[model samples]
Structures are given as C-alpha cells and as structure tokens.
Target: MKSNLVHKVVGSQYPLWRTVLLIIVLILGLGQTYVSTHFYLLYNKANSQHHDVHHEYYISVTKPINTVASMSNPNANGFTNAEIKNIQNQDFVDRVGAFNPTLFRIVIEPPKGMGHQDFRTLLFLESLPNAFLDVDTTNFKWKEGDKYVPAIIPRSYLDLYNFGFAQSQGMPQVTEGMIKLFVFNLEVKGPKGSHKLQGKVVGFSDRINTLLTPESFVNWGNETLGSVSKSELPEQLLLKLKNPLSSDIGSFFEENQYEISKSDGAKAALTNLINYSSFYVWLNGIIVCALSIIILLLVVYLSIASSKTEIMQLFFLGYGVGKIALPFQKIAAIKLLMAAFISLPIGAVVAGMIVKNSAQLVPFNSAGFQLQLLLVFGALVLLICALVVLLIKVRIKRLSV
Candidate 1:
C-alpha cells in the first residue's frame, strides 16, 4: 500500500511531462557518451593514418668530421676526426657548410636478432628518411660474406636540406633547417641474415642531427663507412628548433638524382595524423556543447508548458513550486557537466592510443601514457565545472514562480 502511494505521488508530482524530460536527459547523457567515444575512435584512426603517411621515408645527416672550438678555453679548442670529416669550410659548396643541403645521409647498423628484410619493414613503417645506407661488403669479400649494400638518396634529398649556412662556418641552422631531409633505404646482413631498412630525418639541430630508424646501433663496427657506432652518436642531436619553417617545404634534392625505395600506402599515411585529430576533437566539442544547450532549452520549455496543472496543484498543497523546480535546473546543469566530462577523457584516451600506437607503428618517440591520461582527466574536470556553472545560470532564469 505504501509502495502504491509512493508511485502515485511520483506519477502525479512528475506527471508524464516531467518524466519524459528526465528520460530525454538520460538519453542525451548516453548519447554524449556515444558521441565522445566514437569521436575519439575516429580521431585515433585518422591520427594513425596521418602518421603512416609521413613516415614513408627515413633520413639523417652525418658530420664526417668533428670540430670543437672552445671560446672560453683555448687549450680545449681543436678539430677532432669527426670535425674534419663533417665540417667542410666554404671551399666545398656542396658540403655541410655550403648552400645548406637539406638532404644528407643516414646510415643504419642493424642489431644481431634483426635481419635486413625485417629491418627494412621496420624502416618503411618508420617513414624512411631522405638518406642513404653504406652497406659494408668488405667482410663478404674478405671472409666470403655478403657484399656492402648501397642505398643512395638522389640529389633531390639535397634540395630539401634547408639548414642555411652560418655566414662564417656555412653550417645549416635549425632556424633555417631544411623542411624535409633525405630518406635512406638500405639493406644489411646481421649475424642472423640480411635485412632491409629505412629511416627519416625527423629532427636536426646545430651540427648534430637525428634519424628515426628501426635499426639500432648495437653490434656496430669501427668502420665509418656503413654506419656510425652508437657511442659516436650524440645524446640529443635532433632537438626541436625554436624557429621552424611555416611553409610546406618541398624536397630539396632533384627527383632523378637518387633512387629511393618505394613507399607503401601505410607508410605514407602518418604525415598529418596528430594534427587532424586535434582539430577534430576541438570541433566535435564545440558542436556537441551547442547541441546540448539547445536540447536542454527545448526540454525545459516543454516541461514548463505541459505540466502547469500538476505544478499548480503542488503549490496549493503547501509545496514550494520554486524549490521543486530546482531539480529541473539541477538536471540541466548535470547534463551539460556530464557531457563535458565524458568528452575530455574520451578524446584524451583516443589521442594517447593514437600517439602510443604511432611510436610502435613508426619510429617517433611519443610521450608516456600517464601524461596523456593526466592531461585528459584534467581537461574533463575543468570542462565539467565550467559547463555546470553556465547551465545553472541559464536554467535558473527559466524557473517559473
């Protein structure tokens, strides 16, 4: 009997009109979840595709010589063997100090377990850079082993080398670095067997440069011909430049000058992956928020218009109609808050997955999952708070006396 009375009170107090509003709110909340999840999924898919596109070619630059000039200490100033090989004076117009050849060589030394073929797959997926590989076949001739595999990037890669010469040293600067670098597609024979590989010039700063490749520098030899030893490589050669080019810089090298390993469709998809997903996330948020507001307003208007009799009776029964109306305002605020909360995590998870998969699928280094999670969670909380406040202000004004 008590249950029936409770039901009757609920039915008459809310009526079909208010009940329908509650149902609509629930649907909208769920719909927000669905949209947020799918948006993230779609964003991840798009980001992955873009990353694939940009990673087709791998590249790197080497300073065959190392020259360290100490301004503070004269005794420490001297040219190392690396300086002699890499830093050319103004004499060699085609060298590093010359007209800023954006295109350079990126040599790879594969590890023991990895073969040339496997390495190549990894390289291709990494979006091979505009560099070449010097396969040392000297052992093959000397010990009846394989010959040195030669992969030469065309002069076109050179054209892409944009580091402008320092008027004095003629070395390229990251501020004026080439928009694109060389892609070196080469094959090597590890202890196990032969493997194909590629790398890209994802970063370059100062005289030092960095290449993203599947091939590790472990088990490398002293011969500077094929690949540089891991110790020889700097810790941070490919640091981000403060001044990057704004334009869509094209390849620096000429097309016919060098032959690059063919790029697969998957390799070419990474070009604009992250950028596009970011844009989409922002756009989706804007659209969803706008739609939520409109839906809330419509629901409130209908609830007020249709439930006049029920509301009046409640007022007569010693109930403060305004207080009862407070729930409607609360529901609207909750709807907006929940939708915003849902969207942020969904977008962040999608971004993190995309970035993580990107590092695995390609050769780039993505931030940790924890960082992405924190960022996403923070964004969601902030958005929820902001939306709740806005909804409260809007809904409170519509409450009838």
Candidate 2:
C-alpha cells in the first residue's frame, strides 16, 4: 500500500538521539510549568482564608507615644484633622478609618455564677466604621437608647485569659461559645453620671487587638458620657491600601514616624517574594518549552536533509507532500504524546510531595488539582503538535522540490 511505503521510507530516518532529547525537554517544560501554576493557585487560596496578604489590604497605623512630650500635651499623639487629610491624599491609601475610643470610664462586670461575683475589670473600647471591621457581626450596631450592646473582642484576648491569666490565677477557662451565652454589664461613668448597659460578646477578631463595638455606639457614648464636652480626636487610623506591597507605603509611614503592625508588613513581604519567584519559574518553563520546540524543528529538518534524494524521487513518482510527511508527523506527535503522559505522573508525585510538606499551611484538593493540570497540559501539547505537524509538511515540500 502507498501508506506502508511512505511509513517505511520516512520513519527509518528518525534519529534515536534526537527523539530522546526531544522527550526530555518536553517533560521538563511541561512539569515545571504545572508546578509553578499550582503554587500560584495554592497561595491565592491561602490568602483568601487568612487575609494575611493580598486579601483585605488593611492595616492600622498609629503614632508612637512620647511619654515626656505627652505630659506637656495629652493630645500630642492624636491625629489632627489636617494630618488625616494629608494621609488621605497619599497615592497608596485608598481610604482611612479613624478609631473612635470611649472617652468615658468603662467597668466590665463579669457574668453571674462564674465563681467570682466581685470580678470586674477596667476595659477600653474602640470602634471603626462597619466596613473596616475584620470580623462580621450582624448584631454589632447600636443607637441612642439601645440598652443592648454587641462587642467584638480579639481572639488573642481570649487566648491570653484561657492560657495565661486563668492558668496563673487558678480560674476556670471559658470557651467562646460559653462566653457568648453569658450576659455582662458595661458600667459607664463620666461627668454625665453612671449608667449600666447590657453587653454581649458577638464575635472574635483575629486582625484587631482592641475590643470593638459599633461606631454608632462609640459616637453616642462619647456625646452622652464623655469627660470632655466634645469627642476626642482619633489616636490611631486604619488604612485601606491600594497595594500592600508598595514601597511608597513603607517610606511614607517611616517618614512620618508612624508605626505599622509588624505582622502585616512581614506577611505582605512574604507574599511579594512568592509572587516574584513564581513568575521566574513560569518564565523558565516557557523557555524550556521553546527550546524543545526548536529541537523538534531541527530533527525534522535533519531527517529531511538526509532523505532528500528519496523524497525527490517519491515526488516524481506521483507521491504528494502529505504522503511523504505523514510518517515524520506521526513520529513527532507520538513523542509529544508520550512526553505528556510521562509528565503527568511526575507532576502528580511532585505535587503530592509539596502538599505533604506544606503541612496544611495551604489547603489542597489533590483530585481537583490534578484534573486541572491535565486539562491545561493537554491543551499545551495539542498546540505544540499542531505547529509541529504543519512545519513538517512545509519542510517535506521544500525538500521534494
């Protein structure tokens, strides 16, 4: 048959060394690209859950208290309206929220039947705009005459009492569920005289350290019970950044002698580093893929050169270019297909190793990840094969002429 004749003549010219080299590059290219893409996806998932980097993009900025200077002017550390306006004009800042602190004295009486009836602690409460809250509490709003107040305390506060203070004092540790169920009283006192407001824990925040109520509650409390006749200016500002990793953010904060949370800065730095590394890895994979494609073209040209006489004679004998190029195209396709198959298992094993070593720092669904990788790598190989097949036909036509 004509097919059999074409296969025997062209297939014999495939150099063994060139075939092996092509396979190695293809596997290296496909496997590295898959790994880099997987890393990027995993990082995005982790950021979404933790909001440590890239997710919320909010940080609390405050001026350092100067003890000696504060004695001369108590409001020296507080942000002036002009200072806030200057920060709002910065290119990196999307918006800023001021912390509304309670200007009246607050006494938190413990819930009844907790073994210590006389237990009371002096507590400071602050609030930000509802949009600036890291934790969502639907019940955390208050208006004038509302006796019930919902409070959000930091998780670190509970941890400190449960693991440190309670243990040292031989007191019972309370869980979040237990604490939420208990009702407490906020005894607020100022020039307007003392009043008791029923308070309940609505949620716990991981991002903020201060106890938070609703902004409306803080504003109303300041107006009604504040020692001063007017509300105090904010001592701290919460900034929503356009990009947390921007160099201008650090420089601006540093120049103004403002302090940012160390944890937020470190997390953003780590995320930026990972992003740059992933891009370089992805670029390298593309280079390897390009090299492999170049090698494939070289193999086709060399094979055709060696078989130039036979190809010309076949063309003279009424054999079309497609018939002569079929065997070469099939060999290239098979090599690419084999590389794809081999890369899958290699990629899977490497991915498994990463998931195992990551130790739940990032969540992974092995089955879903593998399926995505397969679809993506398959498309890449298909495109490469299509290009190779077309190039093979053109090469054969030129040699035959």
Candidate 3:
C-alpha cells in the first residue's frame, strides 16, 4: 500500500491547484497582451493625426509669394521687353513647379456690407479661386429668382494661390454695379513668408481685381499702389507643381539644393511642433509597458515562492521518507515559459485593438498599421523574455540547497 501511494504521488502530475494557478497566470498574460496592443494602436493613430494637423496648421501660417517685377522701361535694365517677359515666365514656372502651391494663401476681402450672393456671383464672373468666406444669412434677405452666385477666379489665379478649383462649370452672374471692393495682397510662401509678412493680411482677389483694372489703377492713390517692374523679373514662367507630396518634392529637388537661409528656423519650429504633439502618446506607451513588466515579474516571483510548500508535500506523499523533493528546475522552467507565452499574445492583441479603435476616432493611415504591430510585438517579446530569464534565475537560487 505504501509503495503504491508513493508511485501514485511521484508519477502523478501537479493537481488542480497548480493548473488553476497557471490558468490565472495565462489570463493575466492575455489581458496584458490585449491592453498593450490596444495602447500601441492608439499611440500610432494619435501620432499620425497629430502630424497631419500640424502639417495643415503649419502650411496655413507660412504662405509664400513669388514676386515678378516688370521694369518701367526696357532701357533702364538693359533688357528687352521680350527678355523680361521670358525671365519672369521662366521664374514663375520654376518657383511654382518647385514647391507646394497649396501653401499659398489667397484672401478675397470684399468691402464691408457686400451681399454674399452678389459677391459669390461676381466670383463666378471673374473666375476667382474658391474663397472661404463666412456668410451672415440672418441679416441678408434672400431675393427670389436670383441665380446662385458662385465664387469666381481663374484657374491661373487658383494655381497662383496654391488652391484647387472646383470641377463644376458655369458660375452665377452678378448684377453690373459698383460694390465695395478692396485690394488683395496675396501672400504665397510658408511660415518663413508669414514671418516676413509680419501678420499683414494680403489683399483679396476682388480687391486685386478692382485695383488691377485700368480705370481703377489710374484712380488709385499713388502711395498705396505698386506694379511689378520688368528688370527684376525671372526668366521662367511660374506654373503650379502637379503633386504636393513632401517625398515627391524631395526627390525633385534632390539634385538642386534650393537653399532658403530662413528655412532653418522654420524647420526647427516644425520639429518642436511635432515633438509637442506626440509627447503624450509616447509617455503613456512607455508607462504602460513598464507597469506591465513590473506586474508580471511580481506575479512570477509570488508563484514560485508559493509553490515550495506544495512541492515538498507532494515529494513526501509520493515517497516513504519525509524528504524535500522540490524540483526547482522544472518549476522554474514552467513559470518562465508560462509568463512569456501568456504575456506576448495578450500584449499584441491589446495593441491591435487600441490601434483599430483609434482609427475610428481619428484619421488613420492603414498602411502604417502593420508596421506598428510588428514593431510592438517584437518589443513585447523581448520584454517578456528578459523578465522570464530574470525571474527564473532568482527562483533557481532560492531553491538551491
């Protein structure tokens, strides 16, 4: 009977308790995996959204303008009219083709009290760039049988302002009458230009149109009016660049180092902006990962410590002699394996969920998701391995006689 009991105890594996403990550890591991995955996804989504918003806001603030000068007299600059036009045409083409056109700002300021309908109608007539204007519908009474007024500006004008024109044709016509029209001072350049402009709001398209007219230019005050002189004009005709991707521009400008002395400061400012935007997400991710590792290590240590009494009891129950038979190596191996296996998948799932859910909340680029997942999973695996090794070493030492 004694020998049979001993054989049963030694040969039999750990009872329900150890299995229960392992299950609990696995549950904890899975939970951590889910949370970690979710956190990573959230972080990536936040980072991408932050970058887009920063880029948009930065572009809005930094508007660039290309200046073309038309000389008063060809003899003044020792150049012919044709040469001057050629130079300006070439310069316009080169500059417009080189950089992002959408970075330019086209402001259209109609004189106060102008009806939105009339303004919109005139816009279609003039073929102006689409203008972002606030309409006060409450005060203005709508007139029946009045055609819908469309913003008017030419495709060239939109190109100049780095704006895209609507595809629809036929703008609404406005009644022929003198309305309050102001001059527009266009600012085309990025943040560097904005700084140079010193917060000066450029004249609107309507204002520029009013001022450019032969009669209007002649009547304008001399002090407030200026024209592009031919002498300072460039050779290239400025045409808008087709695509505005940073990478595309980078590739285009690879050979030609178009150095802007002022861009250094602007670049530094942009870096700071990006850092500020992404700081919170980065910090949170770090904290969560750290906490997870610490909790996992603590659980492993407690499990090892608690298993000692049970392991010794099993040894005596299997053998006649009341001898300590704690197989520390096997127990430690199990603990290490369990900790690692449990933590990895849980972290990955959590990170994935977080990323997927965050996409719903913000504009996320799907292309980046897989890359992020791979990076995060790799990090989690490394972390769990490191923790398991450390815990196993400590447990083995404690069990050694």
Question: Who wins the TM-score comparison?
Answer: 2
**lDDT: worst 10-residue window of model 1:** 235-244
Evaluation by lDDT, superior candidate among 2 and 3: 2
Candidate 2 residues 183-234, lDDT tens each? 8978988887778888999898877778898888877777788664243678
Runs in model 3 deviating more than 4 A are 1-15, 22-26, 45-361, 398-401
- Please give each candidate's TM-score: 0.33, 0.89, 0.35
Model 1, residue 35: C-alpha shift (Å): 7.6
Q: What is the C-alpha local distance difference test score of each model?
A: 0.38, 0.79, 0.38
lDDT of 3 by residue, 104-185 (tens): 2323433345324234211101111122111212222212222222122322454433333223333333321211122222
Report residue 376 deviation for candidate 2 (angstroms). 2.5
Off by over 4 Å in 2: 45-54, 228-231, 308-321, 364-367, 394-401
The positional error of residue 52 in candidate 3, measured at the CA in angstroms, is 4.6
Off by over 4 Å in 1: 1-270, 307-325, 333-401
- Top candidate when judged by lDDT against the true structure: 2
Question: Residues 1-401, candidate 1, lDDT per residue (tens digit)?
Answer: 63343224423433566545544554454344444444454455545655423322232222223244333433232234464343232121122211111111333544444334344332211112122222222221111122332222333334354333233345443331232233345554433345454433333222112222212122231222233222332211111111112121113212212121223112222333444555676567546645655666666555555556655665566655445455555555565556545554554565556556545654433345345544554465456445645554454334435
- Cα error, candidate 3, residue 144 (Å): 46
